[model samples]
Structures are given as structure tokens and as C-alpha cells.
Target: MWPASRIPFQGRGGADFVEFSQVQDPSMSHKVQPLSSLDDLRAVLRALPGPDDTARAAVIAREPTLTKPPRSLGRLEDLALWLAGWQGRHPPTMKTPRAHVFAGNHGVALWGVSAYPPEVTVQMVKNFQNGGAAINQLCIASGVALEVTPIELERPTRPFHQDAAMDEDEVIAAFNAGFTEPLDGVDCLCPGEMGIANTTSAAALSMALYGGPAETWTGPGTGVAGHALDTKIRVVAEGVALHAGAATDSLDLLRRLGGRELAAMAGSVVAARLARVPVVLDGFICCAAAACLKAFAPDALDHCVLGHVSREPGHQALVAKLGFEPLVRMDMALGEASGSTLAVPILRAACQCHAGMATFAEAGVTDRV
Candidate 1:
């Protein structure tokens, strides 16, 4: 979402915790978390199916028709490439899909990067539980198991959530906690998040990773515009600069300036890679977390799928750089993993056609231009 992002940042998972966002101020500091060692970072790179792609090329080569195509289906061929990477071969499998949306409050929302107040996070979690949320309703209609986890990343004003969601060290600890899950059976995993003023958090993480000014990535989030957005950008720039020096590890940066939902989604990304599952990408907030994961585990990039286009400019940059095709262009910014939930049936259809359509010889039809 920022002007650049060649470096790493931290961001979530299923079945463990929820929390609030910790924000940084640009006026505060100059140092940011640096990878402990290049080797430690390299240790996580998966190398991603060896770049030759000879086998996928073979699968398409085996198809009977040669002239009726030159990437004839257009974008469908693009989709084919993503699925092929997931299967480690052609004809990928799409079965037993699950989607998760992580939600949390932001400590910085108190500074007003959003029009809505931070209290909205708790209510939305309740809505998710009651089946009123878009993710809940759509998942119910589609029969995909959807999970929502709200973590209090910031120390709560109330008595309930101190240890519930992740902190700096907590992020890594949560990863270890969820590390045992077997992700092979999960064919689809989509990331979505909830946190008031989280776009500011997203921008800050982008700033840290890219070392760019905050205005470059900041955008209208939840109807904010004009002065409020400018304020959001200015505040984010300050937060990024302020927290830059305090960050000792990736976890420290996230805790000092990230939202709970982003942390949880980060865990999910790491888990999906370890288990070899493909995750559908949602919006700016989620994609920001995905970028964090990409740095932490470059191989995790192999396990991701971009779901839809977000109204947020940040998401668009992430999609372009991450190299994923959006399934729809509907100006949606609802968050909560709703885009991926809706994209499921369409993705399933793609898998169905790729596996079910008969070849020319089998159907007694000649290949034609």
C-alpha cells in the first residue's frame, strides 16, 4: 500500500486469540525492527515450486487443442496458474474450504483515523456471532466454515482482555501455539480483519516496511475524507516515525503499532504455509498482514490467493505487487473477509470446469479456432 515495501513487517491465524491495535507516531523515533539475521529470514523462504514450472506447462501442453488458444480464456488462464501452484501440479483441488476474519480494537483509533469509534469492534464481533454479519450470512449460505476471532492487542481499559490477544512477544508465542495444525486438508483459507481505524495501522506497517511517507499509502477508509483523512495520514506518519526506534523485533513493531486482528491474520498466514493450504486474500488490512507474512516466510506467498478489489488504494498496490488477479471489481470495503466468502462459489466453479470439462477426443468434438 505504501510507495514501497522491499523489507519485512509482522501481521494472524485461527483458533487461538484476539486483541486491539497498538499504534506508533512518526515524531517519536527513527529506528525500526531489523531482521535478526539474513539467514534467519532466509531460513523461512520456501523457494516456491522452483521457478521452472515445467510440469504445469506439460499439463497445458497435454490439452488436445493448440490453435483455439493463445491464453484464449484470458484471465481464466491466470487463475489456472495460481491453482497449479497450489497443487504442485496442474488440476488443483478445491475442497473443504474454510475462511477466517480476524477482528480487534485499535489503540490509535482513540486518535481518530476513523469516523466510527473503536467501540464498534465489540459490537461487530457480537454481530458475527449472531449471524447478522455479511461474512456470517454468506458463509452460512455457501456452507463454508467461517471463524471470527477478536483479540485485544492493546491493554484493555476494562478488566477482561489483558492476556487474551497478542502483544509483541505474544505474536510469536501465538504462532508457536498454532504451529501444530495440519493445513493440507484445508483447500481454501481467506484472510479478513476488523479494527476501528485499522487503515491507519495498515499504513503504519506499510511505512515501516517501505520506509516511505505515510500519505503515499493512506486512503479514505469508512467514509473518511478531506481533513479527517489528511489527519489520518499525518498521524500515521508520526506513529511510524515514533515507533520506528522502539521496535526491536517484528513482534515489537506490531505491538507498538498494529491492530489485534492484523496479528491474528498474520498467524493464519504462517499456519496456512506450514500446512500447505491456499488462502484467499481479502482487503487492504488483510493484505497488509499478508505482506508481513510474505517477509517472514517468503514461501507463504505460494499459499495465497487474492480475492477481490478493495476501494482502498492500498489494497490495489498490494494486489499488483503480490501478483494476484481480483475476482471482482465491486468497490467493496466491508472487510470481515466478506469478499473471499463471496468469491468462493466462483472459484469452485473454476476448479469444477478445469477438472470436469471433457477433452476434444473424449467428447468427439474437433478443436477449432
Candidate 2:
């Protein structure tokens, strides 16, 4: 159940808060608070801090003065400008970049949606803690702080191809759990997720959002092959069909198919937006979360950066849906924020270029004639 204070009674800006009475399904042990309705998700959208248009304009204005031909730096120049606009600094600095990995387990894993066992999720959390995971190594090399948070792994979500993955209360709880992080000095937040079969959920959510057949969004997660891959595809197709009616609604799609870590990532994205901190999304899983958030709050895109492009089949489609040009394209599919961490230094360098490069006049260099 949501806290009384968080509950909304009156409509604000044509949005209402859904006040669910109780679980409509007797099989559901937990109370349901439908996040699928716009009424339920409106607060997240409304609560976001508007982008600093002035800072955005300032970056654009400052870019021309840099010691380079106009747009010579190409996307790097644009990225720095985007960061400046959101960071609200004339020359944004990636002084405090943080990476969070949200780990969970999925009941769908039982359907052989992934080649890895469910235990890998727990084992990898330890690997993350011990700085043995790819993400940890990347963060260390990039000098970004890393935190691994395990979410409801012991209690895997219900198999959505059979039933709802989680009840509304569970969804809200996951969101709240992921939403609260210390961001006092953080300039950028990179959110990643780890869960066996999560790609299945990401695919399910993407299909739901994009209105495609499961084959269009489904892919071999964790390198499941042959029979396993075929089973994974079939299971994802079934899940999509099971919740096909909710396809048009974002929150509903999430409630039906999203993993706990996915919901938490979405919540964290919202929290980052509220704090006016920009978010760098990892690969497909994080992008799915961000996509759901964008469906609720379109402005949240202004605060997000696609860290890299994943080889996952649905990733490009999701990126296209959000219209985000990924900062790097390494064909990475490693979860646990590895892709995002790898791009952190590049983003920092972009900020450095914006801040440190001297203008042609300042450098006493002749202009391009």
C-alpha cells in the first residue's frame, strides 16, 4: 500500500491518482495499486524538475567559441551541450558520477528464458560486491562510484506469461526502493539491472510499448541457443499474448511484465530527474525502464543519455522509440551496468572538452577563413 501522503485525491494537471480498493484477484496476496493508469503515474511526471533551458542555451552559445570549427567535434560537442543544458552548468563537469546495479530474479526464468541459472543472479551480486563483475571493473577503471543493490531476488516475481509478474503494491515498493539514493553531489546517475531472464521481461515490455509481435522484440538472452532459444521466444510470445489487452498503456504494460529491478530502475530514473541529475542508461534493460518512464514523463528524456548500444535485437528499436543516439556502440550485451560504466569516461571527457578547451580568441588562434 502507498503511504497516505503519497496518495493523490484531486486531479492535478489532467491526471488522477488511482486509488485501488484491494486486490481484485483473489490469487493475489498483495494489495494492488494499478500503476498502469495515467492517474497513477502522473505524479512521477508532474514531480519532475523542468530542464534548465537557460543552461541549454548557454552551452549552445559557448560551443561556437571553442577552438574548433563549428560542429568540428560533431556529436561530442552536441553531447557536452546536452549535458550543460541538463547539468545547468555552462561547462558541465562529471565530478560526481555514480553507478547503481539493481539485482532481482524472475519467475519467467523457470521457463528457460535464459541459459544461465537463477543462482547466477545471486552469484553475480557477490561478484559485483567483490569487484569481479565486468561492471565493477569498468567502474573502477572509469573512477565512478559503484553500488550493487539486490531487490526481491529471494521472492521472484510471478510468471507473467501465466499471471501478473507482481502486484501493484510490490511494483510501488520496488520503485520506492530504487528511487531513494544519496545524490548530494552526484552529477550523473547510471542505472543498470541484473536478473536471470530479465531480457525476457525487457522484450515483453518493449513489445507491449511498441505494438509488435514477440518475435520482433524477443532475442536470445544470456546466449540461450537452439531449443532453449526457441523456448525463450515462445514463452515471450505467450507472455505478450497474455497481457495483450494492456499493450496500449505503459504503466499497465510494466505492471504485467516488468521485473522488480526494472521497476526500481524506472523509479531511480524519476528520482534522478527530480533531483535535476542526468541519467546514463545502460543497455536494453535500463533502456526499457527509461522507456517506461518516458511513456509516463516524456521530459525525463532530457535528463537521460544512452550509454551504449547493445547487440540485443530489441535495443535498437527501443532506442529509436526514445530517439536517443547512444554515446558509444560497442555491441555490448553485458548487463550489470558494464556498458554504461564504459561510457562514463567519455561523457566526463566531453564535459572536460566543453570546460577546458579555449576559444579561438582566447588561444590567440586565427579563425577558419
Best by TM-score: 2
Residues 20-93 of candidate 1 have per-residue lDDT tens digits of: 11232545422222223323334444443332265367546644343334566565555555665554555766
TM-scores, in order shown? 0.75, 0.87
Q: Write the residue-wise lDDT of candidate 2 on 275-360 in tens digits.
A: 66788999999998778877766776778888998998889888898898888899889878888888888888888888899988
Give the RMSD in angstroms, all C-alphas superposed, for model 2: 10.7
Candidate 1 off by > 4 Å: 1-58, 61-70, 88-90, 141-143, 153-167, 174-184, 245-252, 296-299
Candidate 2 residue 333 Cα shift, in angstroms, is: 0.8
How well does candidate 1 score on lDDT at residue 292?
A: 70
